[model samples]
Target: MTQAEANPRTMGQQETNLGLSRALPNGSGTEELVPSRYAVQVGEIEVLVISDGVLPLPTKMLGHNVEPKERAAWLDGMFLPPDAFDWSLNVVLVRSGGQTILVDAGLGLDPDLNLPRAGQVVRRLEAAGIDLASVTDVVLTHMHMDHIGGLLVEGVKDRLRPDLRIHVAAAEIRFWEAPDFTHVNMPPGFPDALRAAAKRFAAAYRSYLRPFDEEHEVAPGVTVRRTGGHTPGHSVVRLASGGDRLTFAGDAVFAVGFDHPDWHNGFEHDPEEAARVRIRLLRELADTGEQLVATHLPFPSVGRVAADGDAFRWVPVFWDY
Candidate 1:
């Protein structure tokens, strides 16, 4: 059956051949109000994963055919078949000492963003005992619509720019802030994902988010570094103090981030280069033994890379999970 023909609403799970259910964490391609989870302690850094909601789609937009199949080995072994896609978006709250830092903002009010509960960034922020105004800073890994959408609030009162030292890469700031992306050369009929992403990015740069560049220490022990690929200005975060070190590997990998380096999403400005970064970052993470964080993995979206046979695998860490 076609993706639209099979349980169109989005809750149906696409079970793997081995019966590993691969349903989108949220059926709607939008983020929804999720129940509260605990704030975890990582030595000195405390992180919380708040659900801004999810984006449930009909097919895996980044679908790739895997080789060496097993009985019912769905889509090689990584993706859920029937072409359905369900991706989640989250905002990470990091606390150290008395400092409150938000890793990335979610889709604040863009209906086009299709987040489950349209404007839950505020609610999610509050749920974690954080006040939007109190967030000493907001850090963005890139300017993709989903990653930076939550930086602004609707009301004149709840805005995100109130002294929050927003951090981004130089290339990232220049890319979206430019007026020509609406004309970038992408083929027609490019699904709503890319189109909407482009639109939201243009809007975000013009109205919200503070532009930043390489090596901005937004807070103690937190430094933003370049991890470009998803976008020109894409970046990853390095958090360290005493001995604990963490790298927020934004969108470097998606759902099954470790299965294949080529499992890059359709949005990467350059797919092959993105793959290169994935592999290189894997080495950096492993070599340095740094804690890694993914913006869209599962809840808590933070982990470390482990060697599984030949390829690197995403291993969610205890503190950030």
Candidate 2:
């Protein structure tokens, strides 16, 4: 039975109730927290990252230059409205040639966090007319709960069938699953949630992970590129077809204002390393004409990065339907 049907409460619910409709030019909206976007089709290759929901955070989540006045000035500089910071978690799905790929599942709900909005990725996928079980391969960018939490269904594990090989960066899994060093205080700007998420995801990974390297063909037209630093083993994926290439840049770029390459998100485990990788990746992104599909770049987060003086900004260009 489909995962949705497996649920006892909404056995006969209508499609719209499941958030299966496009809300804007390139957005997928749900009645959840805030509306979000889903990306599908990268130059003829079907690509999408279903949204789970928004992580409510304080505004200015990414610390700009010090000084209170300067911070507000920075916010004003970016045209940010009031004190606001949040990220929309995205679950990716890529369809290249004939192969179907799902990258980073969303957070699956449980008894404790009976949040209705959680676990909506599959429903969003269905709204887009994509089936969950048909997924041929699942490649995790990292083992964060926000990223890998959607792998299993509510209660039934056996029915959560994925017919393809699961790929993970060898180092990525080892690092997250390694013995925890929680006593020492972490650095400023470090993301503690990621550490807890690692613990949660590691439990699931014990049964599902398979090793992958820096450069590997995940499927017929998809390639896994190690981007590292954000998470010790984080990797970005490239989807190509019809002479065109699109990179599912994952958390390589966070929410909107922080979209600038120099602006790193507050949730990075290692800020310096994350910044270094972000700059380098942005450089490569700018060099290649390939389009970029980011998980948190304001939904349907597909775009291109270009150098602007010392930093880089995304130039959105998603046209496929």
Candidate 3:
């Protein structure tokens, strides 16, 4: 039985407290009322999903290819604002085979971007009792600023071990050299910001990069496989041990993907291929009945996929407390 099942009253009270806390002013020094990290045990491997924070983006970004009215209808059906919504930024930490692997670094400080709510991975990790120096390997899904910017934070590299390995797709590293932004439909200033961030990340950690052609095993039960859709070298990390399985789908899947898998997201470099990749991954997960976690899904985005008619469904797992 789950914690809520065992003590529903306590759970309800906790929820009430959280609701009240949300009214408090920001930076009030009160302990965070909302959960920022969640833990899951996949067989013997340990996994933790940390919330880097949320990104407020335009609603058009969700599906640039669809009609505005169609998008608005969907948003209205979900009771969300038609103008904008917050996208959760999730980062995963895995421990297996005596190595601790950080799946993707959250967005670090980018003052010009005006996204101050993000870039909390460092502080959240510390609060979770994880030291930056403990991370042995970092498996990047792509070179997007949100995925690699945390490592570029001031003094972060100095705190990390000198021998840290950052595994990324070779195609990804090369694409960033001269990225093509013609296909993407991002907000103003995003293209320049992404380019500058990727450049800075490459220069800052050139010696630590471990580029891979297709797939690489960072530790036992942890393998990152290149998918090449959202970006030239986008990838997803698969974890399997003792019959338990999970997939950390970087940008291939989004919240609206289940209802409209073919919609093109504004951030996708190759929207067509991205939709294909999303459909393929969703089908696979539905067939296998394994857990799925993604970067942009809601916080603690631990869930399973289910085939629904011509589309798919997201069945979030009960929180384990």
- For TM-score, candidate 2 versus 3, the one ahead is 3
lDDT by residue (235-260, candidate 1, tens digit) is: 88777876877777777777654766
The lDDT of each candidate is: 0.59, 0.62, 0.88
- Screening candidate 2 with a backbone cut-off below 3 angstroms (N, C-alpha, C), the clashing residue pairs are 37-300, 41-47, 59-84, 59-85, 106-150
- lDDT score for residue 304 of model 3: 99
Backbone steric clashes in candidate 2, count: 5
* lDDT comparison, 2 vs 3, better candidate: 3
Candidate 2 lDDT for residue 103: 84
Highest lDDT among the candidates is held by which one? 3
**1 versus 2: better TM-score goes to:** 2
**Over 4 Å off, model 3:** 1-30
Best by TM-score: 3
Worst 10 residues of 3 by lDDT: 14-23
Model 2 segments more than 4 A misplaced? 1-39, 64-68, 110-119, 162-164, 179-197, 255-260, 318-321
What's the TM for model 1?
Answer: 0.73
TM-scores for all candidates?
A: 0.73, 0.76, 0.91
> Rank by TM-score, descending?
3, 2, 1
Q: How would you encode candidate 2's per-residue C-alpha lDDT over 231-271 as one tens digit per residue? A: 76788998777687877777767644334455545556665
